[model samples]
Target: ARAYRMEWPADMTVFEIDQPQVIEFKATTLAGLGAAPRAELCTVPIDLRQDWPKALLDAGLDRNRPIAWIAEGLFGYLPPAAQDRLLDNVTALSAHGSRLACEAVPDMSQVDHDQAREMMRRVTAKWREHGFDFEFADLGYEGERADVASYLDNLGWRTVGKPMSRLLADNGLAAIPQSNDSVSVADTVYYSATLSK
Candidate 1:
């Protein structure tokens, strides 16, 4: 929303898609602010676990036009099959010049899932002590997911992968501190890609 408010080009439309509950919360919060959202901003409310592409199309997305897609902090939450399905849908909808930027998780098979889950539980409990009520372990899918870079490569997308530490340093930001379950915080990657002609 802030990006749409501050940086979206006038000629381009921006669609923000999320679960219905999240969308409802955002809508209500924006309404309380008493200011109209940008004309180019379209909020599409649908569960990604369902028929989200149809809902997106119904919300005025143009499949024929090129789009820049971002999936920051999202894929990790979905099951491996759901992740693949999302990519399939995006590929189906994308036009020739479509591009994507996403944050990629490391190979879950290489991580200690039990340790990671316990660490997250501890963090969540600490937060709950301060009034936040949410199960952190419920927020992510931990298993052997497909490699995002490999998947995109197989689809003929030109992709570049960078470590999160490099990305942060390039942007002059500090790297994330190491934690007990370093696999959860370390080894994250980022990818930028363009569809093949």
Candidate 2:
């Protein structure tokens, strides 16, 4: 599959395309709208939530080489068990010094089911109209989930950085007028964290 934002040279070996046309079009549009280093159209079957390291291993890609994996806007779609499973797979296939970057939706323990469903309804209007019918539970790492930082640290990764509310405020990000809980009962509990090996 083509790597977006990757820098390519004239002599660089290029791979074939294997993703959907819509994704390719979106990638190209993104590249056009932003200063992405370089991107190629590919013919890869893209599975955002798949066990990617296994896929690479099955494809004969070396597991010993450091790989950079990014999961954006995906953590919220998985259940807690699946989240752990995904992380386990990452640890299994990642060589020393491999890096991962992702955004997670944190826990939604405080949310009422009715509100959550209503929110989902509004968000999934298009899909629902297209015949989709499924309810989702909180799919992110609760700060309490096995002490995520420590778990990863034990797995050889280190807590590197995070954009906590205090950090954001220090960086001139104005605090919200009121507590997030007051604004939205379904608000998540934890700030995003970054970990690296």
Candidate 3:
């Protein structure tokens, strides 16, 4: 995907990558590679899986340094087991002062397969036509209590959570239409967190 970037002065370092997921990683890697004006760009293979966190650790992602990891719009696409495994992997690999943020989608355990499939049927059908219909399991922390946070805490990281309402309000979005009318609506609520080991 092509994106237009605001140009910076020639002396400023810049990094660009073709994929949305790698943008920050590439930018950080670029800045780390040089003290002078420079840019580094690379495409991570899609076949790369959750092991990336461990790989980054092995590659010496600085634990003493604050790093940002994002799993945007990704949680629901993974099975519950995979979700847990990935988070566990990340927790094990992250260093002190590392911040990880993500939108905690509804865990599949909270969703009925029939309802979820029906609700997402159209998109799934479209993707299947294109030869890729990703199977999904919504999985994350259990509640406002932040299960993910507790899990991370056991791994020696301090944790904080940001709720979805606050995020929407920050971005000037009004309450979703018809959202407040039902207590039973599967909370698509997102829980975000920061952790420092």
Candidate 4:
């Protein structure tokens, strides 16, 4: 960047990408609270399933520089193909040395459908009482899917994955109860990776 005379900001610009409605709501709420972020924050409103890489570039992301990407609580919300596309997009946009961290949910087909449905029923019922009723099962895709870590590994990312329970125990925290139930997240795997030069 210095060689090219790119006028990148002294402070790193953190981009937060999400749905248009979500971005709007967040902006409104933040304005209402007079909240301020410590760093330069750019909120990009675009559907992840669409041409988000272009949208992000338009929002001033510097692909020439290393980007630390986080896919927190994101993949399960998308269909398997969309999830794969998202990963591809991220990998394509990243420069060498760019790092990524994501929380990977198990393949939905491996989960207990009946148990998941019952759990969602109880949770959605409570939301309906509060006038915010929506079916996640309808929004979130469910079926067999490729493992995130393996997929990224094939794309040339040096990867490391650990279960949430293992992370907790390593941090000296009490472990969450392990279960085969869909609602239990103790076994959720988190992956961190870097694209090497």
Candidate 5:
């Protein structure tokens, strides 16, 4: 949606997909603001757990055209199997030159699950004090999950993984200080890859 607000070339079309409630909220808010999107924007309201490809196609997505797909802040919320399924669908729909960028969680094998859960509990409690009541631990699937970059590599995609610290520095930003509550910040990696096959 933010991309659509920017005045890009007319040939480019931006599509935003999300759950029905989120789509509804965005639509309503835009309507209330009377701010129209600058470029062609399509919003597809479909659950990720369901057939999203069909929904996207119905919304006028061109499967033959190359696309830049972003999966930021999403994979951790889904189980490992679901993540694989989503990638499979994406690979099937993507054209030869399509690109994919994602933020992936670090390997959890070395971390203590109990300690992680406790940390999340404290974070959740802090959020609850401000009005949001939700279990942060329950929101994510924590276990031995496939390394996203490796999975993409095996699927014939050329992958490049950048650690969060390096990424920040590359953008002329300082890295965050090391702290107990900063494990996630330190562990996250960003990936940018292109389909080669």
Candidate 6:
């Protein structure tokens, strides 16, 4: 859809990386909708925890060119070490001026883990009621993690971040009220980083 809206750039290729089942399901859904990719689309079916970097490169990712990577709702599913490793891999593969946009979870030191978990459960239950059955707790790895901005800054990437409430306000939307659960959208911190040339 994005490519179509942009009139399909011939020089650009979009890579979709995920587990085999997810890739298959996405393909099926797109085909069922009678949709075709407007730009070159390559699907790499593999778990992110595996050697996905190699798999991506094998699928013809051009590391020499600036890349734009988006990790929407991804880090919360990975362990702290895995998150660091993922960033390391991306930094290594990225050429100068590469861009990364990701969701950076907050430091949960002051958050009540039990309360947060319960609230998250409630959110997931509501989602299930609406036909979104993905298990938030079962798939997530909760605990302490490094500050994404600091990590990227040390890695020579200039980054800007905004919390969910700020994002809403900046975009002229009313902020959703959040309780002490800390697991709500109040905890969402999005970061956009660019590797310096």
**Best model per lDDT:** 5
Local distance difference test, each candidate: 0.83, 0.52, 0.51, 0.82, 0.87, 0.86
> Number of clashes in model 3?
2
Name model 2 segments beyond 4 Å from true.
1-44, 48-51, 58-60, 119-147, 160-164, 176-197
Q: Candidate 5 residues 1-197, lDDT tens each?
A: 67536777878788888999998998888889887887788888899998999999999989998888989989989999899888888898889989999988878888888888998999899999999988999999977889898898888789999999889889999887887753577679999989987
Write down the TM-score for model 4.
0.87
Clashes of 2: 8
Ranking by lDDT: 5, 6, 1, 4, 2, 3
lDDT, candidate 1, at 174: 92
Clashing pairs in 1: none
The weakest ten consecutive residues by lDDT in model 4 span 1-10
On a 0 to 100 scale, what is the lDDT of residue 161 in model 6?
95
For lDDT, candidate 3 versus 6, the one ahead is 6
Model 1, stretches more than 4 Å misplaced?
2-5, 35-39
Candidate 4 runs further than 4 Å off: 1-10, 126-131, 178-183
Residue 172 shift from truth in candidate 5, angstroms: 1.8
**Between the candidate structures 5 and 6, which one is better when assessed by lDDT?**
5
- Number of the top-ranking candidate, with TM-score as the measure: 5
lDDT of 5: 0.87
Per-residue lDDT tens digits for candidate 1, residues 24-108, read 8877887888756654778888788789899889988999988899899998888888888898888888998899999887777
The runs of at least 3 residues in candidate 3 whose Cα sits more than 4 Å from the true structure, single-residue gaps closed, are 1-42, 46-51, 54-60, 108-110, 122-146, 179-186
Which of candidates 1 and 3 is the stronger one according to lDDT?
A: 1
Task: Kindly list the per-residue Cα lDDT of model 2 for residues 32-117, writing each as its tens digit.
Answer: 87744354333334563665555555555556766555555555655666666766787777777777665545445555656656
lDDT, model 5, position 26:
85
Lowest lDDT sum, 10 consecutive residues, model 3, at 136-145
